[model samples]
Target: MSEIVLRNVCKEYEKGNFAVKDFSLDIHDQEFIIFVGPSGCGKSTTLRMIAGLEDISDGELWIDDQLCNYFDPKDRGLSMVFQNYALYPNMTVYGNLAFALKVRKASKSEIDEKVHKVARILEIEHLLDRKPAALSGGQKQRVAIGSAIIRRPKAFLMDEPLSNLDAKLRAQMRIELAKLHKELETTIIYVTHDQTEAMTLGTRIVVMKDGVVQQVETPIELYNHPVNLFVAGFIGSPSMNFFQAHVTEENGRMVVFIGNPKDGKKIYLEGRRSELARLRAMDQDVTLGIRPEDIHEYADAAELGIEKATVGMNVTVTAREMLGAEVFLYFDEQKKTHAVRLHPKNQTMTGEKIDLYFDPKKIHLFDQNTEESIFYREETV
Candidate 1:
């Protein structure tokens, strides 16, 4: 329903601690933008600033194309759903939903209509007469959301609204929230530390760390093509494995050196010869990044390029997780360990050793200093 923009926004507390710094983002109308990062990453603080709950120490805040730096929270036409379901325990669900309108002395018929409409949308109409103590956690959360919805504000700001729910209920609420977004068509700014929630719910994700915005893109784009080491490591499950490697020219070809002098191995990457050449020319030591799923067990070493520089290393399988369709193989090799995703059929017993191959094309190379992707080209093949 409204666009929110932050231009060079910053927040600083006593002792020169910066909570958020030089942050600028444009959230379009009806878009669900999720701010995600680890705790103390300034995501919640940023949301509070946008909601007019915190003063902007620097820069401008705009809502619906209007400068809202000095505006009151209510006058900004934004509704916020907090992490804790801040429902009045004494009030029934309907009363909780009607409180805001009652404070403004809205007509009795108008209040009833708005509250019931929101309850119906949230599917909590049956629980309207029940107090918070009588409602389940999910029901209470729905009432909290309904309270925000009844206001019909220009935008919705939710800060980890489903954090208190159980895992199963969380999943259900996630779907319901997505449905709510579609039905309301209002700009939503949600904050969460959970990567799964951020990935599944966001139309565009703003990945932040240490008070700085790392990447702002679609979920798939961030997952497939992260901008830096932090985003790469933070955005995925079972996180991408990182190995310090040196880039060297071997026989007119670029290769990344993996493993140490003791039980060492060298992996050669075929594509992006030009990019590797540039990095090598600059004498840069690159970090090799590969997702667990990208490393595959070779059925026939001769069928592929596995013989070129493959090293025979002994891995002690520590644990195996079977997820029906796929299995996770966790193992240790040469004092270093990693998780390799494999078919459920390939679920090797603990202490068993298996041969695995790393796909060069699926590997990512990042500049050691800048931590930016240097070897992976974005142009579609």
Candidate 2:
């Protein structure tokens, strides 16, 4: 296994468009690192640079402590699996897997041994004699992976290898890929635009946007404690709820304004006095962020300090989705649409007005100007 590191790496096209800009990251030995972002983000370009498929305009590329900026792709000791399952249609699965060995003038017996071993590891031994034409989409992908693994490269670069699979098959293959990583124990750098795949498959995820690295962290950490508004908005499934708000002292308490215009509401925050004072002193115009799951149906407003900020408009429930034990309530609130997760037992009506309770401690605050998180610190408990 080998560690891959990129320091101040950059990729620029002739059009003066920078695909990747001063990118720097270290992929530890045997670590599964995923590069994830939206389309047109530099994820694929970054992966291509590591694979030696694209030239690094400026900066260093290191593999196993060796500077490899100019190393040929074959000499990098890495194998890449592309999105399209680049298999030769004329060759059988076994032949495809053994092609590299054959080109290197290995004995037929040696090639056969390597092919069968990889097929067995990938659980595609039964399909060894079948051509790419006869294989299913998932099977073709497995063969592609098998071919990459047979080389025994120090690192694997997978670029959205599962993108073509169906939803059900994608989930199944995700599990299989994770299992394969454990068995092989080789360094892997996967690139994808799918946040779900990045969150589920990667040991660590690097979120990127506009050719710049945003945040890199474990899946749970990224979900719970994103570094900025962009990371917070991009990483979550439902996408975190953001409200433009002002931080002000009200009734001797530091509160965040919802600024609804029609009927503004103030949500009191529960945090250290010092922190609140610091925020106040900075004159920071904060953006209040809350996850849909954090907002609950107000059962007893009196008990939770929930106050009726207004009763201007009743939100009409547009749709309701029952997700087993819980139901997702999609409704229009105060001219803005919002999603709320509620118990399946609570049969809320479509046109009924519901009071939502916001948990102050679970709230996130962001700097309005910088769009950076202001309430992120290592938790004590």
Candidate 3:
């Protein structure tokens, strides 16, 4: 198995600064793991440390049963695909793919066989005669990937290899890469700033922030159940909306009062007995979170068979964005701006006031002080 382990790994530079802090994870065989965060989040830094391109200031890196913290990149039984296509500008695709084998002193026939096999797998056989200058962006990337896998390394590490492609090509290559992972059945560690790429490509995603690991989970889990405010905001496109509210108990239920009750922004959380008890016990301010998909108009909820809107608020459509199948409605309530998604067919007009509903069961509450999800902390505790 090509399982890789990182134990308390850290990368520190001058002046007591660290690029990665106490980073640890287990990447199982044939698993696709993505390290994702905003720029400068240390994802690329971590990948470089794993590839032996950067020195680890502390901790251990193990591949299979071998300690690889001090091993050379070539000796670590791993190959990397980089963001920039590192193909030789002076050589043909065939030469580039066979470069590693030539360096290892493999026989010419052996090199030819491996190169052709990898070219076939990457669907780049037809482009073998082309040089880097002659290839398109996507084709050059394919050649780059083909060259990396030509040696049949135990594991593959890719650092934002698709960032150079256009949106259409990026999407197409996502599918191709997914297929390659399945066929090759090799462990993969990918680093990217794109959450969409992380969600669609990785078997599991590691979300990071400020050079620190925040959460690691499957994409769906990270989406439906984020560990903190950062994960909840980063994992979803259009992000989750947040509002500061005061929690109080009334009539054996928890009422979250946000903005102003006079403005119709107050709502009660129901049906969660344990959560209610916890909220009632806390006299502190809390942050309320709801995804755009969960905020809907009363009629919209009923039409979609969603549970009846537990909380009602009157909001104005400040801005409207039509996205073919769905629309994004931005509004302000209780002095806080928020957005809700609706079917485009609903014909919502800007500047119009309408009553919207929030699904009580779908709401997320976070501690204002820690910015951690209350639900997540409760479950883990």
Candidate 4:
């Protein structure tokens, strides 16, 4: 049961600047955790702290029942897979896998057995005799993983292991990596900047920004209920769209004022009592957030139980991207590039004006001052 507990961990360097601030979490045994964010977000720094490669300036690092803040990386009983293959060019895959074992003084028979077992598990046994240069990128990665797994460490720390691979290969590796986690039953801490990898591979994802942890949650929860504007924008591909708007009570309902007040394109929230109250209580100028898929062509609204909009905006299509499965329509709105996803067969052309509908129930509202989700703050609390 190799659980890890971090209590108010921090990494500070030079003149009180921190690369990781007040970082804390409890990672359970056999869990696949991913640390994700943009460059210089302190995700990799945090992972290095866990691996004992970086100093923790404050707080505690506990692995299992032992304090490991100052423990040597090898003494901490964790192995790491780096982004670079790091295999010796002249060494066969089998030799690279057994090199560490040899350094530890394992007998030849023992080394041979361990290397073959890990090779078989990673499905690279057929290439065991091949040198590093003879293998493809994916094959070399498998060798790197095999080298790490042969020791049977307490946990595996992977630093963007798939970053060097192409798109199609990366997708395949994500699935394999997930399967490996389950089969090994070892705690895994992975770091990457790709949201798709974070969503697909992690059992739990840690979102970070500028040396601070923003949120940690299951993939679906993070995607469905982001806590702030940064998360909502960073988690999804193409991201969520934001519109500057003000909220006010109109008659017995709460309405979101979009575009100009003189314009007739506003969303009405009448029967949504709970959401209405949540908005009306703190209602003011807010950024309205919506996903591309949430916007629908008028003909498709009924299938989703969304009623006809009493008022809607005519969006002029400025660009379109076709992916065979669906189409993304881009339009300029209030000086922003807003997008909507529609069925591929829909004949939306560039420079064409079409009425698009926004689903009020799917809309998210953020406080203009704080840029935080009013609904999420209350729910999380």
Q: Whose TM-score is greatest here?
A: 4
The full ranking of all candidates by TM-score, starting with the best, is 4, 3, 1, 2
What overall lDDT, based on C-alpha atoms, would model 1 receive against the true structure?
Answer: 0.83
Q: For candidate 2, write residues 16-100 as lDDT tens digits.
A: 7899999999889989999988898899899999999999999999999999999999999999999999999999998899988
lDDT of 4: 0.86
lDDT of 3: 0.84
Every candidate's CA RMSD:
2.4, 2.9, 2.0, 1.8
Error of 1 at 297 (Å): 0.6
Residues 1-381, candidate 1: write the lDDT tens digits.
Answer: 588999999999754788999999999999999999888999988999999999999999998889999999989999999989899999999999999999989999999999988998999999988999999899999999999988889999999999999999899999999999999999999998778889989999999999999999999988888888888999888988887666676676566666553345666656554455455433456777889887777763336566455543356679999999888888775366778888787857898888777766666778877888774354323
- Higher-lDDT candidate of 2 and 4: 4
The local distance difference test score of each candidate is 0.83, 0.81, 0.84, 0.86
Candidate 4 lDDT over 1-381, as tens digits, reads 699999999999765898899999999999889998889989888889999999899999999989999999989999989999799888998899999999999999999998988888889999988999999899899899999999999999999999999888888888889889888999999998788889988899999999999999999989888988898898987889999887776775677778666786677764543464345434678888889998888787767656454356788999999999999999999899998999998898999998888887777777877877766855544
TM-score of 4: 0.95
Per-residue lDDT for 113 in model 1? 90
> What residue runs in model 2 are displaced by over 4 Å at the alpha carbon?
260-264, 273-284, 300-316, 377-381
Which is the winner by lDDT between candidate 2 and candidate 3? 3
lDDT of 3 by residue, 1-381 (tens): 698999999989765788899999999999999998888889888998889999989999999979999999878988999999798999999999999899999999999889889999888899889889999999999999998888888999999999999999999899999999999989999988777788898899999888899999989988988988889888887889888776766666666666554444556665553475355335567788899998888786667554342556777799999999899999985476788998788776998987777766677777777888877745443
Model 2 reaches what TM-score against the true structure? 0.91
